[model samples]
Target: MVKTKIAVLVSGGGTNLQALLDAQREGVLTDGEIVLVISSNDSAYALTRAAQAGVPAVVCSRKALGSQAAFEAAISQALSDHGVELLVLAGFMSILSADFTSRWPRRILNVHPSLIPAFCGKGFYGLKVHQAALDYGVKVTGATVHFVNEVPDGGEILLQKAVEIQPGDTPETLQRRVMEQAEWKLLPQATQMISEEIRREKDQ
Candidate 1:
């Protein structure tokens, strides 16, 4: 069985990346192997995590590039150079261009901190999603793994798991719970689903 080559894009600490790495090591990712880790920020600790795991890491700093197009091009080139079959956005902050999304379509996946459509869309990301959910007083908040499209968080949902919002739950606390319970679990499961589907298709 051929394993699909996956490239993870990150901007910060890469907790999600770590989860995927752990899953891959445990053989949970199933027919998908994380081949490369790319970061939009040079100082992102995600690169360090990838290096520690003995995975190739690359930096395509958005700040260093003159334009958004250039930055997108660099990312695209990196994916192509690595022969990535799937792209996973793990705490990656940069908004990819429509051209890039169109090129990849459902081949790209992202794990958002909220169930989406409630604490999602433009201007809602990272802790902001949890903050908005907390401000809205939602009793249940969770994570979502969805295919990447042109619109932000506007894609076909693959998996979602709700995390109960306890009393006195701050955004930080809620974020931690969601990451531990939902994001970590759902991302790997969703990736495995895609990988298995690809394998089945190839077999047929």
Candidate 2:
């Protein structure tokens, strides 16, 4: 069986990266193997996680790049150089433009911290999402993994898992719950699905 070469993009603590790594080690993630991790922040703990995993990681600081185009180009160059066949935006903060996204089409994946169509879009991310959901008084919130497209969090949905909003749940608590119950489980599963798809196509 062929394993799809994967690269994870991150900008913060690599809890999601750790999940995928744990899954891979546990044999739950069989169809893909993470080969690289890219971070927008050089100081991000995600880079350390990558190092501990023995996965190559590169830093492309947007502040240093001086522009979104330059930043994305640097990232693209790194990805291309590494021969990354599958891209996973685990917690990558920078928004990619249509030009960059178009090259990968459905080959890229992102896990948004919301159920999608709700608490999702350009301005919604991280704790802001959970805050909005709690502010809106929604009883349910979860996570969504989707194919990357030009629109932020507007891509085709691959998988979603619902986590209930508990009584008096703060945004931080909800975010943690959503990550553990939804994001952690869903990402690896989606990775498996996409990886299997890619492998099947490759083996053909």
Candidate 3:
């Protein structure tokens, strides 16, 4: 089996990145290979996770660039240089430029903390989604792994795993639960789907 080359983009503690690495090392995620780990924030713990795993990690900052386009261009070039076939947005916080999204099209994937199309839009991220869920008394909330389009959080859905919103669950509790679910299943499942899609394309 040809392993798909993937680069994970991160901007914070790499819990998800570590999950992916663990899954791969354990043969739970064998269809693809993590080629490089890239971070927008130099201080991001995700970079440390990559380093400890012995994976090549690079820090590319948007602040250094004069514009978002320039930043995207640099990152795009880096991806090309690394021969990355898939872009996994592990915990990246920046909104990607349209030009960059056009360049990669459906090659990029992102995992959102909510069920999507519901608790997702501009300014929805991190603990915000969970807080909103609790405030609104929603009975359910979950994680979504989807393809990223030019617009923010407006991508075609690939997979969604729902978690029940128990009463008295704080934002932290809910977020932890959702993350645990995603950690065990989301990344590996999405990678497998991408691998299967690539195989089908090759056959055709």
- Candidate 2 or 1, higher TM-score: 2
* lDDT by residue for model 3 (1-204), tens: 777888999999988898889989998777778889989999999998998988888888889776787788778888888888888898799999777787777789999998888889889999998999898888988999999988888989999999998888999999899999764479678976886676567667
Worst lDDT window (10 residues) for model 1?
194-203
Stretches of model 1 off by over 4 angstroms after superposition: none
lDDT of 2 by residue, 37-112 (tens): 9999989999999999999999999899899899998998998898889999999898989999999988999999
TM-score ranking from best to worst? 2, 1, 3
Model 3 alpha-carbon drift over 4 Å, by segment: 199-204
Which pairs of residues have clashing backbones in candidate 1? none
lDDT of 1 at 165: 99
Best candidate, TM-score:
2
Whole-model lDDT, model 2: 0.93
Q: Please give, for residues 48-78, the per-residue lDDT of candidate 1 as tens digits.
A: 9999999999999878998899999898888
Please state the error at residue 25 of candidate 3 in Å: 1.0
Cα displacement (Å) at residue 85, model 1:
0.6
Tell me each candidate's TM-score: 0.97, 0.98, 0.94
